[model samples]
Target: MSSDAPVDARAPGQKTFFGHPRALSTLFLTEMWERFSFYGMRAILVLYLTASVAEDGLGISESTANAVYGTYNAMVYLMALPGGWVADRLLGARRSVLWGGVVIAAGHYVMAIPARWSVFAGMTLIVLGTGLLKPNISTMVGGLYDRDSPRRDAGFSIFYMGINLGAFIAPLITGFLGEKVNWHLGFGAAAIGMTFGVLQYVLGRRNLGDTGDRPADPLLGADRRRALTRIGVAVLVLLLVLAVLAVADLFTVNTVVNSLTIATVVITIGYFARIITDREISSTERSRMKAYLWLFVFAAAFWLIYDQAGSVLNLFAADRTDRDVLGFTFPASWLQSVNPILIIIGAPLAALLWLRLGHRVSTPVKFAVGLVLNGLSFVLMAAAAQAAVGGDLVSPWWLVAVYAIQVAGELSLSPVGLSATTKLAPVKYASQMMGLWFLATAVGDAVGGQVARLAETWPEPTYFLAFGLASVALGLGAVMFTRHISRLMAGIH
Candidate 1:
């Protein structure tokens, strides 16, 4: 392996214990606290919106709250395109992350103010802040390791654990404070968490060194300019369309659907145009890119189900669950902790299981397993939903079980798909390729909100059943196409 890009500026012959670098610790803590704030606030958002006006909530209708929740979450991921571009092109990842953290902290503090306007402003800032922070941070994590280092996967798994750890604890603490006392207090707590994250990242600068330093190569400049131009033009067109819709009073469901449809068409055309115009890409590389695009479609299905934990599941717990355990009733918001808790417990074991099953199982096979497991989790939830019909409460254990199974699926797919992205992406367009990957996630989150709103009209069992069956079918389809994808991934190993 080449030593061209040294992650940590350590002296020669210095030992890294447990096959990982020291800087991992700093990044770990930084991400942990960041996720702590994000998830903590997320756990309470929908519940706070839908709570009675007498309880100090805005008393927004359930569907509207879900729409806002979904749109906010979607925009958070969508903004990463610009965030990643800015970091890779001009600001560098380290500075972008720091600025992002500051913005996020400010956003949370805005939410802490006791006013509706403040809440809206805070959410807007948070969405933009997350766009800046989230993708850049992950890129920094990758920068911490040398390319082709065997420890890369292990390091990412460890980083993923840090994410879940914060997620696990945030809701428990924040939910308690919000439900038992004041909602603003919970938001304030999240602000404090982000503040700590910012402090830690700032203090640990030496550990990061120049890993996210700007590229010295001149060729990157042209790439950056082209990407920016494309994005700017797209945004301008979108804004104009939205402006026209607003003026015409067409900013309704049909308008949203049309906007999304047009966005999809534009993205499709843009990708194909890149393939035609870029002479650097080989036929084989183009084939691999096509496969990756398909994987993005599959991933959208997975997130459409998984991202509902904050919106629909939170509401389900508040309205339907028997929250009492032992003698005391737990806050409904705390149910958001279930998936993270399961991730914390199940991730390492799942990694070990995959390693043991390695050689016997292909990556595509594992992906299929993940999809099936995710579907089964929804099936289990569907059963629970049926049992809980007619306003009767169901056992909390059912929710726990569902989350556990879903986490199992997440463990199988999330890390693996990230690894696969680098393997399959064309080297020249890597950042944009990753942007598309995140765009799929954004679409899924937005759709998840729409799916959750269906519960208002349809039986919960029907919603779960439909999601479960679609996931399973998608998984099976991926399995059937495994050979083609494997061929695309030929050089990765």
Candidate 2:
């Protein structure tokens, strides 16, 4: 078992990273730079899509851009399912992370090439690479400590800080370059960041020891061959489908985005159905999974409204927010930094608040709180939109306020959901349960992308008000069902 692996992959006299394993430093830095690249690119994606072709932008409609953004996010999360499987069965976490980083760096470099087709091509590669890297890195981090070690939680907390730190810094650098200089130059910066992460990861492999040196559950000869064949067929089928679409003149962005959206929905429904109907799981486990279904819905709904930060909200910042600071206008993407910065500042505070509340608050109640706060943020956005009427630009503080509220909501729900997934997961499907959690986000982002088309068609205030109230109503409904969901949790806190 991985628990038996060396926690400190260093000579006895060697230094440690803040008294934890030296390996923590390696994984931490890898994750940080990876996040830097990811968020840096995301900060400017929609802006680039909607900018004039004369200005070296894609010239896509805002609605199409939003859908593209949503679909892109959906795919990134969705790939984690197979990504984990590959780590467990084929490449092992170490190789998977290494290759994933290589692919990710390549993707960013491709995006830096300034060709129209390169953006989409690069995004596809990035999604595939991210899927492989993201989940496995966390797994390796977990391998560092025993299951019940107190240091395990502290280690993850430190790792979480790395994520937010990278996110906080990315937009400042990339936004300036992309908005002020060339969009491709900004993407090139992201490429450089990932390349740094990859190089350092390789150099720091000595610290990793044998943490993820081999597969958790490696497939053997015949089975491995079958799996590889299946993967090959899947890829072939996908390419063939694209070829057919192009030949039929139906390979438009909208067509592909809509199709992927529908597929996400179907995959989610099928995933749930397969698990719930499984003969291997016990009745008690089935009941718990049933409760998880509700949580999944709540999580999906929460992300639907929350993830709009990059698309609808980013556009609002660009077009409707007054960015003038003593006649120097800041890039709209700079606002993307607000969420991570707030999270970094508020995460500890939220942890303390939850510690004080303890079991009295209940998971469902906390989720309800998250939903309400998320909705309230959007409700405030409606007011901001109203203020921007008559071709007037509102203060940038409006967005800062919105992101602050959303961060509060995120701090309340995200960590709690991850904890709950681990607690409520069926023993037989433990790892896959994490995949299901990621799917909840995928479903939300995919659907939210389709929903965002309304932002372009409807009045901004009405659009914000309707969705805001809907989330509030869902939160209230969650409040009403708390006791029932609690019972279904079957003693899980």
Candidate 3:
């Protein structure tokens, strides 16, 4: 279940499917299709970029491609800030999600064109569309049940499962189209998925009632006009700046990556400072804030390690690892599906473990465990590297094993971490903490790209071993300091 699923949006005495609200079906399908489109496009993006020009690709260097990939991923999370604001103050969640899907479909169609500018324009539109859609869509799922309803968590769990179902299937369909037929076809498939999602949501809108028909905090008429005008001006300025950069060739790979890296660090530090200095919070809350700062650190490290499943790890599957089975070679993009598959299988078991052992296990302890598991995945990658060093193709199980362990770490860290943030959040800063969580993810992706680029500097075994050990050391350090962080958490588990 998504811990971020808002409790305030509950529906009462509502009709249900299987004891949960009937509206969940529509919302679930919408999210499922949206994720399918998003992950489907993502599954093939970097591969298309790095493929040779002869193969209808841009033929960019690996380092540059990694930087672009990282920057794009980071932008998605960062954009959520403005996205949520826009939904709350201007367009209600319904309109935002509806238009977001339309924009996304248009983006995909743009990508289907053969021009390089189409790729850039398509990705930009998708990012903008996701910003509008991603933050607002699942919010309605939270509103599907009454506040006191016991089924709310179950509904969110089912909703979460639906999203992952699409994630698991995306690579199979899009990856096959991208790797076998045409990359543009893969993008087109994503567009088709979004179109279906939009249609479903439209048909099912009546079930939603007035859940997101109006903004929670409505703006006055003049203020609304002013806000919209400012928004338009900001967007126009941004476009003009981007156009200038592209025309001048100032949109270099390093410039993009370095800018995001700096932005992440500065914003992260500023958020920490704001929390620590806030006078309205209690001393204990401040202590917990300090502790979450540390959590933020490990969170970044964990994502830095985990996100490689799509970057360096994907490349490894394509190059070093053997994909052949009885002369039918597997598509490299198919490997992108493994983590989501494991998460779908593992999340419930982990949730149960936490329920059974919530008090016995501390938040810091879980973080430590998650960190260690992520570290161990890289260690397995190192082992894989060693096996393939002699120029023999390694077993596909090597990459599969790494993804399995990493998914375990994700199960421990991701959802659990979200829950912990909500519980530990200061009264005035609850939403801010959620944004901070997104910021950590943004930082992780930006830094992860730079780290992936360094794979070129060292031999495979050394590269894997070095980062792997760093993670293990961090995990052990987190374990050793568990009691201290527990103290700082002020009784939060």
Q: TM-score, each model?
A: 0.88, 0.99, 0.94
> Sort by TM-score, best first: what order?
2, 3, 1
Model 2 lDDT at residue 295? 92
Ranking 1 against 2 by lDDT, winner: 2
Write the residue-wise lDDT of candidate 3 on 1-493 in tens digits.
3322333333576666666656778888999999999889888888888889888888888777777777677777777767777777888778888988898889988998887778778988988888888878766676656666777788889989988999999999999998889889998999899899999999998777677666656677999899989989988998897789889999876876787778877877887898899898999999999899889899999988887777788778888978888998878999899878988999899999999995898888889888999999998899999999878899988988899999889888998788888888999887557777887888888888888888766798888889998998999999999999999998888
For candidate 1, write residues 96-174 as lDDT tens digits.
8888999999999999998877777898798778888888888888887777777777888888888989998999988
Q: Model 3 misses residue 32 by how many Å?
A: 0.6
The segments of candidate 1 whose C-alpha lies over 4 angstroms from its true place after superposition are: 1-22, 213-269, 272-279, 488-493
Q: Model 2: clashing residue pairs?
A: none
lDDT of 3: 0.84
Query: Which candidate number maximizes lDDT?
Result: 2
List the candidate 3 regions with Cα displacement exceeding 4 Å.
1-15, 243-248
- Angstrom error at residue 320, model 2: 0.6
Across 242-323, the per-residue lDDT of candidate 2 in tens digits comes to: 9999999999999999999999999999999999999999888888899899999999999999999999999999999899
Residue pairs with backbone overlap in model 1: none
* lDDT preference between candidates 2 and 3, better one: 2
